[model samples]
Target: MTSPAPTLLRPDGSNLRVLVVDDEQMLTDLLSMALRMEGWDVKTAGSGFEALQTAREFAPDAMVLDIMMPDLDGMAVLQRLRQSGDDVPVLFLTAKDAVTDRVAGLTAGGDDYVTKPFSLEEVVARLRGLMRRAGTAHAAGAEPILRVADLSLNEDSHEVERAGTEIELTATEFELLRYLMRNQRRVVSKAQILDRVWNYDFGGRSSVVELYISYLRKKIDAGHEPLIHTVRGVGYMIKAPQ
Candidate 1:
């Protein structure tokens, strides 16, 4: 018999609230049900306006937002949130698979993106990744510092530095780097990265991982002995300089 999916719980054994925003009531309901199954507190909004209101009231730990809506689009809502200094992590949910759309969402400070027709498990996994990387799901007394070579990450402070020089990272970038650093010296396949970092097996493109790897190399490996390496016909690995 197939086993039931496991629920994701916060480290403190309390519910982590999530706000699901979509113009489609069915989608919001479906997402709420999925999130609730994970023992998370789930709230739904059927419009951009409602999402904004609910987000403020609920103060969710993370949000799943739809890109298209009447009057106020997801981009505009996100812009408003950032403008007001609300740094809540958000995952964009949309049917638009265009590169520009994805770029726009990321540029607007979205932490992740999932296209329409996504699986419930994938969504749950992605949210779990976001929460864990954001320190929302980490249990008390967990290791707060991770280091490889001169690169160090402070999980509590959400800071990354190498060789005493501070490095700034987007939430997604930090999550990707954290995953790599945690498995340092182990070659992790792109599929594994997708599942671990994004919490989903994204069918969109493998280049997404390559793109982030390139981004990391620029920030983490620049002017240093290259710590990230590609295994021909395999995957990627991060290790200290020899």
Candidate 2:
């Protein structure tokens, strides 16, 4: 699938700010460039102490945090941030490549995580998700609001609400739901979904689509009349319960 032009998410007429925290200069440089290409304001920190200082000064909408550092690990930095009342969305970068490391980050209040040697696309996609879910940023080129039945999504604010209740979604889940909402009741095949949401065919990874749809159903259709329906072999559709 061809990639769309990058969309900037400017909050309050200013570019959304993000901080990349990692000890490696080369990695930070590369990550910062990718984020800047997205038209976001980017900053980098080389250590946990620097991250804390930059977090206070930059007040980023979200963070690309690393789990390992010399003096203070990302976990400690996150703890201090929370203790200082900072609730910024955090996406952790882990070099350990272990479940314990991933779980530790999440259990310590990290919002999302990606292992080392990850693609720039994955990191950018994740940061976009985090910012959108936090309502700290928004899309610029599309109709800001999309709706089907009582479910409404704001592309600009990254808000999704069903009926009168606001729902919280992770970045991937949010993007998947956005695609379904944009298509409304039209049936979308798994291949179409994979391309649209992840920006690549990803080796025709349709099972991931099925997985995310189920996730959306649990949140979007559980207590309410189902808005997401599996069309058997045809893929999926989101429609009103009437």
Candidate 3:
């Protein structure tokens, strides 16, 4: 299925800020050109450290990060960003088409992925998709907070807490957790999770979900009783301590 068009707005009042992180100067320039044509403020970083610095200064509404980079990879960069409580939406650019790579990127907090050698049009389209999903142009006001068991999520603040302790989640992890919390006790299948959370049905490859679950476990379930459970051969579920 085709992705939805981004809710593009003028670069005034609520103009979207985007950060493009890539090693390819030509591709980065092209992306910047296309995004600027759409009236977005864009920044470019050729390395992970530079990307982090740019992110701090630019505070982008969304980020386009390359998976393969020197010093620190996209996944590591994403982890650091999340750890710093930045929920900026991330779209990964990967050179490898391996499922493991895709799953790793998604689990590490990427909102989306576009394989390398992609069309500029497709990249712009996907960026818009991320922005739309992030509610950047819409719902700019306060949103309600939600909770299930010890986990709490503030939609307005984009902050998550577990057992009264603050937990940092990437845009993708937050979305995934929100989906689970929305369904609560319901057993959500991997297919369903991929469709709703990733906005793509990744067929039967549930490793993405599994990988994200591991990430969540490290953050939310570590040093405590497990709240998220795998339902062998079926799917996953989140529940209160029984």
Among all candidates shown, the one with the greatest TM-score: 2
Clashes of 2: 0
RMSD of each: 4.3, 4.4, 7.5
Native-referenced Cα lDDT, model 1: 0.86
Ranking by TM-score: 2, 1, 3
To one decimal, what is the Cα RMSD in angstroms of model 1 from the true structure? Answer: 4.3
Cand. 2 TM to true fold: 0.76
Highest lDDT among the candidates is held by which one?
A: 1
- Looking at model 3, the pairs that clash are none
What would the per-residue lDDT of candidate 1 be over residues 29-146, giving only the tens digit for each residue?
9899988877789999888889889988998989999999997999999999999888888999999988788888988899888998889888887787788777776534557799
Q: Give the Cα-based TM-score of candidate 1 against the true structure.
A: 0.71
lDDT of 3: 0.82
Q: Which 10-residue window in model 3 sums to the lowest lDDT?
A: 135-144
Sort the candidates on lDDT, descending order.
1, 2, 3
